[model samples]
Target chain A: MKKLINDADDYVDEMLDGMVAAHPDAVRRLPETKVLVRSDAPVEGTVGVVSGGGSGHEPTHAGYLGEGMLDGAAAGEVFTSPTGDELAEMVRACDGGEGVLCVVKNYEGDVMNFDTAAEMAEIQGDVAVEQVVVNDDVAVEDSTYTSGRRGVCGTILVHKCAGAKAAEGADLDEVKRVAEKTIENVATMGTALTSCVTPAKGEPTFDLGEDELELGIGIHGEPGVERTGMLSADEVADRLTAAVLDDLEPSGEVATVVNGMGGTPLSELYIVQRRLSELLDEEGLDVAEAMVGDYMTSLDMRGCSITVLDLDDELRELLGRPAHTPALTV
Target chain B: MKKLINDADDYVDEMLDGMVAAHPDAVRRLPETKVLVRSDAPVEGTVGVVSGGGSGHEPTHAGYLGEGMLDGAAAGEVFTSPTGDELAEMVRACDGGEGVLCVVKNYEGDVMNFDTAAEMAEIQGDVAVEQVVVNDDVAVEDSTYTSGRRGVCGTILVHKCAGAKAAEGADLDEVKRVAEKTIENVATMGTALTSCVTPAKGEPTFDLGEDELELGIGIHGEPGVERTGMLSADEVADRLTAAVLDDLEPSGEVATVVNGMGGTPLSELYIVQRRLSELLDEEGLDVAEAMVGDYMTSLDMRGCSITVLDLDDELRELLGRPAHTPALTV
Candidate 1:
């Protein structure tokens, strides 16, 4: 394909350089590091939030690096985790008077790398570091008894809640508490209508017939929980939301987010949510806040996911706070 | 290919129905009309902002219905325009004590339908209505003695700037003025690496080889002005920006938006903007603001677009104002 890249291998670095150059008002590159931070980062006493994962999920980590989202983000190759050193540099660059909070997604490589980086940050900067592993996707089972579930679209909620808490002048521990609370309250379930093509691979991650879908595929195109026949909008919504509600049912009023997995139309997402509402209404659940769009996405998979968070007063207020980021806002 | 849609024809209507059911806090359906409006719309004396287009570009007009973006939106079939009656109902539902402004993309059906609705609103109610046609894409050209230019990604800027002005209590004429000013100052050019498949069509709009790109493609999978060999990032940026600069070069400062047409990764978009920065620097131009993301997408087409808007003081301030829409923020 005709791509605007110098070399496929150097695409991430070249793009990062341009990001710093073009959005000087928003982001700046950390000196001698692959990390991009808010232009006025390292705020004095507030807990610093850092997040990173694959590179292709644009505006996820990097685009969220602004006033009320992430402090710094270390980007890796497409669908690959950053090395320990890269993650360490990002933590060191974001550390201020308070400690740093690493919002690591529950991916094997990402978990291992961020854990190593947290140790490195303690050794290098004498900064207190804590990590919140987001495991929102209800599709995956415990890979191993030692490892937990995989994180998916629910990471965006973690970013928002943590950002709001940090913006409220919360300390590192408080920020971590809010993040963990949000994570516990949130649950997500995703399905893919079509496989996405990885640029390097030059083909879809897997083959899917025109009449089939991959239910609960991973962001990296990992096998879904199951492949099922096509469904009505209501059925799809029921399947996805049933999985989510089984994990954490919203009590009283709750916050809801319907995420599009890259290639699905917004219209379809609404249909999914429509079914979701009917299902929720049947269970007598009330929606306090709702957002539906593309927040976290697989490259070009055509599907949608649902996330519901049972909100208390604090999380509700935090969720309602104003946030200025590239991809999200309150 | 395995979509959760009931039928091809009912897809858009079902999705709209679902949107209203799910986001009761954010959207409401005009009973009998099926248009979507903010739940708290028609604020007294505030100009109403209404926009809509085809279905595939999720969150373009629909997701943007919020505090400072659009008051209402009329969704059509996938890659098709909503009928005139639908547009008229949207206008009525959003009309407040003052007036209503329709931000119509420069497509034949959209412009015609919205214009018809404006006429209907004038005769039916005390509401004042005006229309602003956005023709910002430089990809399409106006033939001699003819006015036919396609609106592309830059329409988001129009919605944002105009929505801000309307939120400030601008009347119909003033809102029209601000929208027109943005349209005149903005210019855009797009190129596609791969064609997207319309759900109903079940096939790509067009085909491209492994190394080919279609430059200047329309938002609705229309043929581009030219098809050329693949180019490097610098070359792609040069070619795209050259058209934009040729159309309207900002004097001192400009607001630049590098938008992906759905499937292009941010990694590639950054490289495109890197070259754009070098070219703008060579021209001694300053960028007042810049943004990059998938704004107005064509299904899952893999490509990016460049938009440059010459900014004056008033336009710059409006652009800088907070816009709390689903797709964008302050």
Candidate 2:
């Protein structure tokens, strides 16, 4: 209820307007739509990559729109899915000569909407479109908004790898292949110390005891696998990393992400990262890369997630490629 | 008390360890000190830029250390200034033949400690050093930790400008001049919806009722100019922007920053930016640059700050120069 916002109804639109204003040279809004695209989108012969979901998890789909990441992103209201029509608009806007690829999370709403958009693009505009669904959250098999496993922070890795491949002049099929591969290798688990409040609701989506935390929490404030007493930073990191490692059983080199759930401080994320690095070393896994920040988040939720990607040589090389986006640059 | 930390004593060290581990290619720690230096420090014939303060402000002094920003940073305990000895060590590590420039925020402890460090380096190591104190916060004339005025988010602008100038091979005096110019032109004001808790204290630094907010709150939870009922995001933005404009009276092109305290969501920051952009337009000021993020922060305070800098051609061009750091890149 103490959020910094004008009106609940205008939250998403105002955020999008602000994003365009802040990074005019890098991104812009599609006319009369809630879709944001790279400033110089629809490159003549390059594969155009796109992604989107709800609005609260910022720097995810929209902030990733730039030269080396997403070509366009259709934003929905907070914790809601974008309309299929808006998504179809994004597909058309991003479809260059090389075709378009949609990188979507594994939520039921997102998958259905993106699928419908792809069909619309193909039937209405003669645009070639492919889809890759990310279901990397190993915490739950079914959730409030998802049918299978939920997609969490690991989606950012998919965006990074697939975007890099597309920027390398790969075709839509190649980009889709890389994105799927990333989904196959990545795993994530999260815990929430506090619940998130949607702008429209103006109250916490869930109630958590002051001394308790929800493990395996979803980004949209869905119930997690366990509700337990609060633990130390090291204990939380261990629980999350162990869940991911047990799920993926990654070998050789891996990429680790300690993503904050909106309201956590960067200092705390680093603390989590330190323990994660130690755990990885103990498991005899070499870290290929490490990212610690609020890459994807629930709106003002005080929590953190750990994501691990088993990186092959190709994925590692692709992740290292230069990317220029509003929230991420490499 | 629901923070992701192991022990209060190890908070700063663990965070620093994690930072270095996550960004090994860009930053490293000095032996036996809480000082982080660029991977390639003391670039010969380049004026070294050094800054530091309490440990809670992640990506401030430490995150800014890189190719074109800070050469080194000395970190203190949570909400405490770094010791003169450690800061002296930082000066020694960063000093090249062209001398070093110390960019100190205008907190009493930080200013005094940095001044002592500069003197120590000049006397013991025979290194030339210059210091620029930033007191751009227009909230009050004096505060709990400062005398003249507090330095808030505007200090980041000083780092960007002076760092770019030094990277251009400017000498100590030149870098000092540019940093001083930035300090003179920039102004900032902040408000907090909730209080920040230091790791050691494990309690809120200050308290606020559910319906109230503190206007012009200091970064370290110092008392602000006024405490009032919570306002809408647009109203908050209008008040903050009006205060900054009144103090700065900036004309022509201006650079603005909407900085979030540690716990605010990016969506809210963008909302604030949207209103600020409109206010700037109404004032007939051209926005030369806009940054919206958690640039400088209190530990986990849910609030935001607004900073505006009147940019001349020199500062504007320097702001555009290429710089690579952990938290910021341009």
Candidate 3:
């Protein structure tokens, strides 16, 4: 449990403080809630986009709150879902004249909370809210935190495409439609070389043999479909891509995201991308865009995920649209 | 050691392959050398900025080769210096008619290699080459790989400032001057909770007890100034700041970079920045800019280094100048 933290009880609040201080122009916390909104919120014509799950996967929901990405986020504690009330407050904070779109991952707690928040936002009368549940992880049918396939790195693409649609003056339903479309097209699979320690737990969420890798592991230390012996970068890439390919029939061009699960070196992420791109090339799918970095992460977990978005022209436009978030700027 | 790599011999080459594939629009590698130049290098009227040392530090040299950063970089094997021939080839590849400025870190191999390259370039052609050796580590006066303090994370700032100067149509002398100025103004100190394993060695570089941390560790897994019981993030901030402040008397607005040594979680890095900012605030130094990410890294070390730059107006403008590199985009 060697972590750089002050108090476990105040970890989320303190992290938010540090984040706001670090990127003051990019994000700001609503006065009393765990909701972080874009510093200049309620951009008059754009539909507000909000997303959240837990705190450990940083630069996710909160770091995406900026001009061309998320408008706000409800950050729960590490690996815990934000309350529906917290999410509803977030929807209200950044709702301009247009409505709000909620991007919820497929985790059970997150789905339930965002669903309740959408109803609450509609009931409150000012903000019309729609939700899109992302289930892009082709890893498992069910997991510790999720009911269906777990949403992993592909959710960042959902946020990007949906936010781009909203920024293009799309209304609530249109933004929701684009988000759902992104969810349908994107698929991801990951392996974990090590588990992460949650601040509250003060211990690693899971353990593994030194040379083993848990393939298709969930973000919150959920069991993967297989626990296997160590594999080379090529073998790891083959396995993860095989799982994803079995789930998705790809053609034409695709956008690839080789996401680091916290503790993996960027060099290794690039290594993974090398092998992953080779696989894509063999499949005759042109790599439209490749994002290789730590877009989302568990707390110091050593692993990575590969996400491919089977793209069409419209989705390509949205995916390639300029985004100026703290984490992903183009 | 658990790592995603193919042949250790091909580690640097494969990483660069993935890098160029991912950022074809920003950078391209020369076929004959490990030199990564801007996709459209030798910008007609601008001075070329070149920096390189090791390859394990992804996004340091190669990732900085784009519109407003390095014009070229020679990629060496992990934790090893690029050969003088490799670096000279890079200078030749990106040497616009104006000149080239080589930014060398203060490691023995790196300084010697870059010096040799600069001389080789001068002897071969009309390309004027100037060098600025960065030694901003306030750690040891001398270490395993250096005659003086090892230039660690502060070297990234030198790249940013120097590259920005070069992009602004500065001549070789001006770019070299700004880089030298940055070298004098920056100070850094680091601590390691765990050391990294170089791929070639196939073992951890160093080891520590469960509750120990090495203060002021070098990027090449060299031991820091001291080893002590692990401290809280607040205590760690105080100790690191105290050491750096003793060496650098920062006045006016300052730029701070809390760089992860590859494996520290962004959450914990923020926890570190929270306390670090508090310390700087207490010392009456305004934080003009703060970068919190793994800008420079040791393979997969689980620790961080804090860099502080005492800024005046010229340095401030250079620091703020737009950079469109694959890693640092503004």
Candidate 4:
């Protein structure tokens, strides 16, 4: 196993320090609970938003917490969801006057832990709590087998919609509604050009040949829907877009996102976007907005995903709103 | 050479298609220019924001274009800058009534290409253009030598600040002022635990022996200032943060960012952030905000970086304002 660092044990703690060193304006550490928060948090009467998941997806939870977004984000070890206790601590830190909204991606560990936190928050005080599960990946046809569809890249969409509402001083219920509405309009499907290796594991998450790609890959290097020989850019676009469009049934207007898994490039995303516009035009869907980038990524996984969200005027306006965080801005 | 791609020739186009298939709302392709834009675009009286870089940094340029950020983005081939012609086409499509502001990472190739586009736009008529070159990486002593610093994760800071100003209806000069102010205040330094392998180049970008890391690495996989034996996470954070502090001179209040090189997990980033805050506290500096995640990355390179931005009220308010895009929110 090849790796770097004097000791693996202190990796998480040390990295957290570096993060604070980098962005003092956006985050602060809770010494007692090890939770991270926006530096000037508990913003008066604002409802707090808290989220967390496995740590490998950087910028997902903590990085997303700030004004107009999450107030606090708890992180677990790499690829491991936070425990209920940890989340409970974060809930305590983030609970403001109105309530607290938990934006959880629909992963088993995440849901369970966040659910526990919600319950704990209720037991602790008058803190109102609500949980919104983001299950936007359309690749998984049925949620029956595995606690519903895995929340893929589309979780970012949920964050924006809910975060915007929260920023506007919406109550927790309204925020939850916005989050749910975003989820309903959104659908996602992704492919993997290659496998990502975990440093601790010291091996590739999955294996693939040079001429092959995995369709419908999960973020944690899990098996995608299919491993097939390579296809043309247009063909792949057709398949992925068809799946999302079918799921959304987006009429009038929609938002499109072309996401790069860790290793692809902007050039490739543009090429894919070209084909995507044509397909949407052919379908007579008015493209209200489009974003192509590595918004949500699986570390070093080469490939891209397409996500479409059917939007009404309100959603469109919200999507156009300005936001600030480490990785994105409008 | 091991790779997951079928053929080199078709990789970019295929990847693009895959991205579009995944995101219909955030992106649309202008076939004529091979550029990607937000589905809700050509908004009246808004300054068009455009950015592009080499292809390997997926979503850095294209994924960021949409809604409140960029009007259009041009993607170059993997690790290569786009031609001026391509950029000009993007400019033409994205330029709204207000004007156009180009946010460029400081790279020779990128600078040349975007500068060419600016010149071309001037030739085209009725387009006001201004650019801000991001030079936030503290690794290089200067920006004019073969061994000069290469722009790394710090480019994201440029995007947020500049994009926010553009979104707020700042004129071309104001956008430039905001971008330049961020560039002056922000500084970044990175370390890589392991090197990454690019498909175009079958071998890894560089080799690091087991238990080693390269500090002050460039985003394009350029050599860093030092390659040393692996150190503790605190030591790693110290090296990176010290470099940034030395460059930015964080006196009163500061903002921080701990970014992964794609492969590092949130667990690691959190650890780094924790230590960084302690370090800053020891230094007697007031931390305004902090962010931890994978903002900018070098493929799946296993490493982390620290960015410190000495802030004033304007920068802070700009940072705090509501903004939205695919990956981040304010």
Candidate 5:
């Protein structure tokens, strides 16, 4: 209810306009659409990478648009899926001579709409399109908006790898292969200290006691597996990491992400990161790379998520490649 | 009181450990001190740039350590200035045979401690040092923890400009001049929706009703100039910009920063940025550069600060120069 916003209906449009204004050199909005693309998108003969979802999780789809990341991203309303028409426009805008790849999260609305958009692009513009759905969240098998597992912070890892692969001039099929590989290897689990309030709702999506937390919570404020008393930072890290590692089951090396759910301070994220590093070391998992920040956030939710990616040579190399985006740069 | 931390006593140390763990390639902690230095510190012939203060402001002094930002940073307990001894050690470590420039924020404790550290470095190791104290907040003439106007988010601008000057092989005096010039031109004002709780305190530093806001709140939750009912995002932007522009009275070519106070979502910050840009355009001021994110923060506080820096040719050019740091890379 205390969010800084004007008219609730104008939230998404104003935010998109602000993003373009702040980083005009890095990203721009497509004409007459809720889609954002790289300033110089649709390169002549390379695969175009596109992804999108709801609006609350910022720096996700749009912030990842740049040279070695997404080419286009269509944003829906807060916690709502974009329409098929808007998504089709995004696909067409990002398409080069080669093809377009859609990296989607595993939500029922998102999956169906992206499928429809891909079909529309193929039928209307003769642009070949491929899709890879990310179901990396090991928190729940089914949730409020998803059928299988919910996709959480691990989706950023997919964006990194698949976008790098496409930027390396891979064909649509190869890019799809990399995206699927990333989805298969990554696992995420999250907890929420407080629920976020949508602009339209103007109240918290759910109620949590002052001293309670929701374990394995979905990004959309859906019910988690457990609601329990507060735990220490180390205990929370252990629980989240244990769940992710059990799902991932890696042997030699891995990459890790300690993503904050929007409202948590960066200092706290580093504290979680420290414990996670110690936990990984104890398990004999050599960390190939580590990222600690708010990559995919759920509005102003005060929580954190842990992600583990079982890395092979290809995924490690691809992740290490340079990427230039609004929220991420390497 | 809900924070992701271990024992409150271990908060600073663990956070520092986590930061170094998460970014080993870019930053490293001094062996026994809470000081973080660039991985390649004491660059043989370049002037060193060092800044530090309380630990709550993540990515402020420490996160700016790199080739073109800061050479070293010393951290103290939450909301407490670093000791003169630890800061002196940081100065000694960052001395690159040329000299070192210390950028101190204009809090009473920070200014006094940094002065002591500078004197200690001169008397102990004979390292040439110059200090520039930034007091850019136009909120009030004097308040708790400060002698003059409080230094808030605009300190980051001083860091960027002075750091770039130091990286470009400027001498100690030249770097000091640039830092002073930046401090003179920049003005900032902030407001808070909810108060923050320090790790040690474990309670909100201040109180606010459900529908109230504190205008011109200090970074440490000090009392602001006025407390009023909630306002829309556009109204908030208008008030903040009016205060800044009245103090700055700029003609043309300015840079702006819309900084979130940790708990505010990026979406809201962008909303503020959109309004600020519109206001600046109406004033006939060309935005040379704009940054919108949580560059400087008060731990988990739900609010934002707007900073306007009147840029000239030298400052504009230095702002555009390439710099690489953990939190900011350009």
Candidate 6:
């Protein structure tokens, strides 16, 4: 039950307050709503890109808000989906008049909630809204949170790629096309060394033996493919990489994002990166870009995930586009 | 004692290899030396600013290697100092014909090692090497790692400020002065909810009781002021802020970095920032800039630190200058 929080109910709000205090120039909160909008939202003629999901996953949606990234994010409670009303607020706030694109994770709650927001936007008129549901996790489909494959760190790539397209003045349909392309090309799989604690739960969401680990772990501390005896760092990387590459065979030049679930150190992430690079080299897939850090995280979950974005020329150009947000800038 | 590492001895090398692989465009490994240099080092006229210590503090010395950051960083063994030979190699590799300034943390091993490197650089006769030892941690004057206050996260600010000055074409002496000024103005204090593990040491560096914490903990997982029962998050923030602010007596406006000790989640850090912003407001100090995340970390320690830099116009301008490194970009 050890956590640095005031109360379970106010955790998301207070966290957002702290975020606003830290980056007032970058993001702002909609009054009384758990939606964070880029301060420069509705940029004249550019399509709006909005993404969001549960809280706890730091820097996922909101942390990707900025010039070449998401225009806004509707935040849910820790591991819970955002409400439909908040999604509607986020959509309206981010709409730049050309159109708005919602990048939803594959979780059922998120898909349902954002669909409601899109319906509301269509009902209200004036602005068009499009939605793309990312289901990149090769680890699980039909999890506790979703009816299909759970979206994981690859969603960050979707935000970056789609947001880059949106910033290029692409309409809602174009942005949605690029986003769906990303969803089709990216695959992710993770392994957890330890469980995480959501504020509401105030305890470890799951438990394992001292020398055990869960492979193909989901971000919300859900059960993974299996709990097995701990493997060496290289073995773990090989397993995760095999799972992801099997799902999406990346060739030519690919972009890799080795993401750390909260609580893992950067050194370990680099170790994972080392093994991944060797594997990619052996497979003859040139790595165009490799991002190794905490882009998406379960709240203090000690683990790591490898996301490989099978890159063609357009995807490479979009991923390389310059962007600035609180946690990510590339 | 679960950690994602192979052979303990290969940890630093593999980690550095991974870093280079992930950021080949940004950093490179000098052959046979435990040094990572900017890919475009020895810029011919700009002063070379180099910093280093033990290896586990990621994004510390190496992460700051880029356009407006350190020209190079010497990597030592895990939680151990780099050899004088490695530091010397770093200075020579970064020299650029103008001069090189070594930014050393205030630790006995680091100080002695860099002192040796400075002597060697002076004797070998080409690069005029000047050094500024950062001793900004206000917790204790002498502790496990040094005869002076152990440099903690505040050292990152020194790299940032000095690196900016160096990038602006400041001479070696001028960059050293700004670095020293950063040391004079910045103060930091940290608390540990859990100790860290060095790859060299196969187990936790220190032990803490359940619901217990240690205030004023050092970066090396050394003992802190005393072990005490866990307090509310706000209470923890109040004490850490008081310690740093009392040491600094910062007025007007201040820049802050609430750094995670690697294992704490961003939500917890935001909670700490929530209370810290309140404290600064009450004390009549405007926060000019606030960075909340893991910048410098001890392996996988679960804790946090607050660094407050009292800024004047020049320091503020220098700190705000654009810089691009692996972990930090501003």
Clashes of each: 0, 0, 0, 85, 0, 0
Those runs of model 3 whose alpha carbons end farther than 4 Å from true positions after fitting are none
Chain A TM-scores in order: 0.94, 0.99, 0.98, 0.93, 0.99, 0.98
Q: Which model, 3 or 5, shows the larger DockQ? A: 5
Model 5 chain A: worst 10 consecutive residues (lDDT sum) = A216-225
Q: Indicate the docking level reached by candidate 3.
A: medium
Model 1 Cα lDDT, one tens digit per residue, B1-330: 445577778777777777777667777888766578988987777999999988877667776888778999888887888888889888888898778989988888888888888888888865688888888888767622117878888888898889999999888889889999999999999898888877798788888888888888877777688888887777778889999999896788888988877766666777788888888889998888878777888876778889998999998999999876656667
Shift in Å, residue B13, candidate 3: 1.3
TM-scores for the candidates: 0.93, 0.99, 0.98, 0.72, 0.98, 0.98
TM-score of chain A of 2: 0.99
Between candidates 2 and 3, the DockQ winner: 2
CA lDDT of each prediction against the hidden true structure = 0.81, 0.92, 0.87, 0.74, 0.91, 0.89
Which pairs, if any, clash in model 3?
Answer: none
lDDT of 1 by residue, A1-330 (tens): 345677778777887888886788778987766689988888777889999987766657787887778999988888888889989988887877798999998988899999999999899879899999999888877642116778887888898889889987899889999999999999988888877766677678888887777777767777687887776767777888888898886778788888777666666677777778778878898887777777777766677788888889988888888877656655
Which of the numbered candidates is closest to the native, going by highest lDDT?
Answer: 2
Clashes of 6: 0
Please give the DockQ score of every candidate, comma-separated. 0.57, 0.84, 0.77, 0.28, 0.82, 0.79
Q: Please list all clashing residue pairs in model 6, or write none if there are none.
A: none
User: How far out, in Å, is residue A182 in model 6?
Assistant: 1.1
Give lDDT tens digits, candidate 6, residues B1-330.
788888888999999999999998999999998899999987788999998999888878798899888899999988789999889988998988889999888899999999999899878856799988888889898998789888889888898889899898888889888999999999999998888988776788888887998999988889798688987778889999999999999989899999999888988898889899999999999887899998889999998999999999988998889999989888
Give the lowest summed-lDDT range of ten residues in model 4 chain B. Answer: B141-150
**Which pairs of residues collide in candidate 5?**
none
Ranking 1 against 5 by lDDT, winner = 5
The better candidate by DockQ, 2 or 6, is 2
Clashes of 1: 0
lDDT of 2 by residue, B77-181 (tens): 988999999999999999878999999999999999999999999999999989999998999998888889988899999999999999989889999999999
Error at A154, model 6, angstroms: 0.4
